[model samples]
Target: MTTKSITIKSDRTIKSIMPPTKGEILCKVSGHPKLFLRVNASGAKLWLYRYTHPVMKSKHKLSLGSYPAVTLAHATAMRLEYEQLLQQGIDPKAHREQQIKDEHKSLASTFEKVAWHHFEQLKNKQKATTLKRKHGRYELLCSYLGDTPIGDIEPLQMLEVLRDIQANSLKDDGTPTDKADRCAVIASDIFNHAIVHGYATNDPARIVKPMLDSYRYGNRPSITTPSEFGQLMRDVETLKGTVHDSVFHSIKLLSLLFIRNGDLRRLRWSDVNLDMAQIDLQPMKGHGASKLRMVKDMIVPLSRQAVEILKAQQAITGHTDYVFHSDTATKNNIINENAANDALKSLGYQGTHCAHGFRASARTMLRHKLKYDKDVIEMALGHITRDPNGTAYDRWEFVEERSQMMQEWSDYIDNLKTGKTDNVIKMPRMRQNDIKTV
Candidate 1:
């Protein structure tokens, strides 16, 4: 005799059903036609959805879940979803497998993983100091979004993370808006990398600018006037007690060269051509594509005074590759970037003067006091300026004129140091014909 099949009404009804003597028993759920509760001879109950693919025309069985774990209501809902997929001519089993694979991919392609890849690309392109700062920013990003899937990040979520960074990352003055701005930029770059590598679809950090506080551009504190700068020089000359001779010379060269602190710290003996009276420099700033793309070899004409400073330094660090080798073995081989600024602080010029401020001091005095060609002055400071015709001026152009200008500038500084204020050299006038019309 054949037994009739029972329709499953609820959980208790499912529990009361008896297993088949030989194999398994299939009980149909009342509202879900394709959904069934299968009970094996050992009473192991499971939910299954059986259907035929409209396109493939083949019977397929998809396991919704085990019984009790997946209640009758959940199994019904899952069956309905699979039935909809079949109606749309999609293979439900294949679709479910693809979903599992996508989830695994998302777990592996996390924000921190992509960020490290992006940082590796910058190691050779960016300066050491800049790389250090960017690494700190990356750590901050990882703290909040490290494990999150890059593709799953949303704009609002990015804004929330950035806002937290802004609010928490405070200096003595207050929150550093620049930190927030920089973090946002770094996050955007990571997302851009993710998109290129197929790990993400959109850059959520791109649109987060409007959510951050505005940052004001402030000039570095500097002694702009010649009188104050002269006093600063005299103070530097008389710097006494505990200051290393190498550091003192580094300060003097920084004053004369006005190069970035990073470039100054990384200076090498090979970069200086004392016999030729020129210093070949590769500035740390403006060397990358994002900032200015002005990364090229720069030539600085050395003054007799500047050349003498290098000659004296040779007595100490000439044996080493770096011009400013560190005294301690635990530290970097070269002088730390903050050594010059710290020396200034020792001389009571902490907030008023900095190592980088020398650039400003030279730029201002070169324009107002020395009366040098603006273009030549800028080139002397390793700045990239353009001609009136919109063409970038060659970095090595006007080498002769710049050499003379450097010599005269050194002489002017000498006069200031000797307190011979009255013996100012009359700057040669630029010929009217030599001046280009804008």
Candidate 2:
């Protein structure tokens, strides 16, 4: 092929080589024998590197980029590198293609991309609240490490990001924070997912997790003694004004049933059955807040006093969907989770007792004061109790025993409030019978 030998040394000289008036033209560089500048009739300029394969001796042209975008010096540098590859028995064209494929793969397996994939996989498995929190955590992680390739993230880099989160968490309270540790847990899960999917070779987050400040799970405040609990019950009953009707009934039920605060607040009219004297529903821990949700329903037998409180609550919020409907809430009809806690705080039970404390109180009192069995109380508390043979307790396994225990518990509460311990019922311990498997 015939070509024009162009003495292109600088941008000015390269720019001076204008498009051909008739068709595209290939102007050969004077010094660089393998490099040529191709100019088209449409005024488009391109740099091309022509080389011969080492084994086959076949000639091929590779693009070095455009004229203005890729300067003459850059083009010469790329030509030299390509010639070195050819000398090493490597085809420059194939090597360039492989590099491009690797670049695309790196972009696709970034931490942000892999984390989003993992988050999407949990959409159906998690509840709305859980999904929302996870999405927030993902966004936080992306803000720091999004552009980084998953496999490229090192343990030290992951630790730095976690420390930043922990540091930011202290801005409000100035106290030691567990945010970093929590974020580390999330990152570990994401890294583990990436490893399983082949996006990453190792979990740097897992390696860095042990380096972070250890987080401890603290239980909510509760009163376990009989006299103190009875005084708290009296205070709740006698407390007047400013409390919403829903909050009042909620506290009463929370004390009597000793179920989770979330379960009590989210109670619906459909879940409660006054005729059956039972509240047959799933606990809230298994729904959104918990990592592992209990699939089976929790059956809460209603005592005479609990049934009385429900009948009273029914007359007030019967029209609304929730049993404890919040009048001030705009987003949901249910009462705020803190409403009862705030009310108890007002009644001088700030750190001494909380809405959730009633569960611990009932568990303790039933076991010590009322002389009830551990499994029966645990079942009533919505806990997972197992038999001696390692079998999980069925939903209705201790229903009968729990029913009697609940009635006695309510009566015991009444006796405590009225200072009538002598009136407490002395009943024989109910024997476990008709054991069934789930």
Candidate 3:
């Protein structure tokens, strides 16, 4: 006989048996949905369930996992939920697991993860410092909006963040404050990354514009000219007792060779061909050991001055593969990230120039002053070739051509500093051949 409510004596022990016998089949529970109580034949205390399946015609047995683990209130709610599912003809177990899976799917697509995924895609395509800066942006996003799920960063919240940045950051024209228009571009990219990877439905940043009613005041500064750039290099040469001298020289070499500073500073001696004045750029940054890390190698030809600098550095440094190094205790180790900038400041030319300002200088000098082919400059810089049809073309960085370029460059710097620079040289069309005497 089955009854909904019954109680075992407080002193008596109860047991559930595979086959019932009169002496052993006692009142199984203490009749309270709030508390489940039973005892097995070995006198083990157990919890029992007395409920009907919401979706099945037959009553099935399920262990409520384990005792103490399945607390009374939790068990009661679970039982009631199953009963409701049964009433609705839904499989409660399958449905619950599916619900958990769905919840996980929602949480997996956070803004931080998606933005990082975008950064990961572009990591190798960019320079090392560029990668570091992008990673920095990701860190900022994590700090400010990381906890907010990807789908939840509405346009208004993004707008607020942009406005706040403008309010506190320094402004041009001596204004009290201004929003970071450049940072707004960064935010747009983060949202774009989310959209590209399906982490977000739309780029919220794209929806908002950083204009004071259509007067788009983007604040990217104009770069220094190659002539002005020459003086900076002279200053770098004259810079005394600065820790950054080594980094500054390396940065100068990068501008002359037109290479990424990250790639240039991280070079090893084994990659250089002093005999041929060439550098067999590895398929990745730092070559040998770091290629396995998925960085692509690029070959760059060393200029005459570049080779001279290396030889000078080697005279003092002794036998080592690193072309650029520091006075740190670690053997075979190079300078840290801040070494170049520190050197720049110590040389008394801070704020007026940058290690990367060389890129702007080179791009302009090659394009206007020397009037070399754009593709040639790009190739020299180890930038991605514009020739879409070209296979991984390994052009031996034409040493003779670069040698002429280097001599003229060095001479131009000397002339600029001595106040003998020609007025006509500033004209955009001035060619390399036109300046016969340096």
- Model number with the top TM-score: 1
lDDT of 2 at 374: 66
How many clashing residue pairs appear in each of the predictions shown? 0, 0, 14
RMSD of each: 4.9, 6.4, 10.5
Global CA lDDT computed for model 1: 0.81
Cα displacement (Å) at residue 47, model 2: 4.9
TM-score of each: 0.76, 0.66, 0.52
lDDT per model, in order? 0.81, 0.82, 0.57
- Measured by C-alpha RMSD in angstroms, how accurate is candidate 3? 10.5
lDDT of 2: 0.82
Q: Write the per-residue lDDT of candidate 2 for residues 366-406, one digit (tens) a residue.
A: 88888887667767877666666767876787687788888
lDDT of 3 by residue, 304-346 (tens): 6777876766675447557776667243377765666666667
